[model samples]
Target: MPRLPPAPSKHPSVLGVDIGGTGMKGGIVRLGHGPKSGTLRGDRFRLDTPQPALPATMARTLAQIVSELDHREKAPDADSRVGVCFPSIVQRGVCRSANNIDPSWIGVSLQDTFEDALQRPVTVVNDADAAGLAEARYGAGAGVPGLVMVITLGTGIGGAMINDGVLVPNFEVGSLELDGVMAESRASAKAREREGLDWPEYALRLQRFFSHLERIFSPDLFIVGGGISKRPHDYLPLLQLETPIVPAMLQNNAGIVGAALAAHADPADGLLR
Candidate 1:
């Protein structure tokens, strides 16, 4: 297999936006020479994801957010690229599914829409894939050379599989079925909250779920992500598995940083669309 592009040096910066169910966040990531070296150019910005979350409605909000970020720069870097991470399966710039957002997003050519809205090139990808890429490149999974699986335990489960820093986008482990139900429905953080399962109870479910993953892929490392990762003490200690599982280091910023890193790489590179 061809080697992936070398990571950008510490000079260039790119804008990365992560669009989620409740809120959207963005920042400018300065490319760096080592893991954990990149820094946001300014404070990150967030805005509410439009109600109804329709394509056109969300596009307008995203445009406004990008403009706001642009205005913050004293002199905008014309070469800086923009990347947008969506909470859906994206392929060839087209969205394949919409679970948290409006169904209208399905089959939409979001790449064209965002490029038109921003008046520049924009790369779109799955939000989980973006976060996983960041973790593999610069966070918990950094330097691990074998299969690394990063799962986001949020309103729904999202997964990304990477090997030696190369991302396998839109893996969709969340869709796996267990007990005739979507795995996310039973094991996601939201599911735990909705079912009112305490830490130990939730940990048991996660233990079974992750053991299933280990059976299938035997990943070298597993990075657990999402807002709940902030308190790993609540759950991480209870699950026992052969694979080394750890909380994500970048937390919510992973998607933004990873999106920016993607923007810095060649467009034709074999990352997800």
Candidate 2:
């Protein structure tokens, strides 16, 4: 497996953005950039994504975040790049679906939205993919190779594949149909919430969910994350599985940081069409 190079000290810090259904989050990250240039200093915070979030509303939110961060840069000469991780399927730069957000978000050109508003290069990616990238690079899958699958169990099941070192985002394993029903229909924490089953019951189903993922991805390492991952002690012990699974090292902050990292990597600013 190819190795991801360390973040060099000479490089400037990359700005990371994480977009969610109700809120947007971000932070400046240094990656491996050294003690000063790439150091992450602030906490992740939220801004409402607006009810019935249309392209305009979302764009406004992004512009505000970048504008604020850009002011914080010590050297006005160093232009910062923006990375945005969206909670929807992002192909090229277009958000194909707004599963977790307002229906107005469908077909939104996320990259253009950010760039047009902020005038900074913007890279757009799936939120899960961003989280997965963080896990692969600095968290659970660090230094390990072959096949690494980062699975985020949140409102839905998010799967991202990293082969050698490249990221394959928005795998959408949750939407897969199983026995004439959707997999997430039974396995998601949301599903359990509706069913009124306890965590143990949910965990039993989660075991089956992970087993299915194990068979499909055949990942050498599994990094499980999401809000639920915060309580690994609660039900992870009840989960039965084959492949080795570990808690996502970065936890909830992975998506925000990964999105920022994406901005640093994409030359054209990772704009979607």
**TM-score of each prediction:** 0.95, 0.87
* Local distance difference test, candidate 2: 0.73
**Candidate 2: misplaced stretches above 4 Å?**
1-6, 9-11, 33-39, 73-78, 266-273
lDDT tens per residue, model 2, 223-273:
888777788887788877777888887888888767766665634333222
Residue-by-residue lDDT tens digits, candidate 1, 1-273: 212356776557688999999999988787767544555778889999989999888898888878888877632464456989999988889999987889988999989988877788888989998898788777888778989999999998999898876787788988998668999999999999999999999999999889999999999999999898898999888988999999999998988987887777786776654
For candidate 1, give the lDDT of residue 228.
83
What clash count does candidate 1 reach? 0
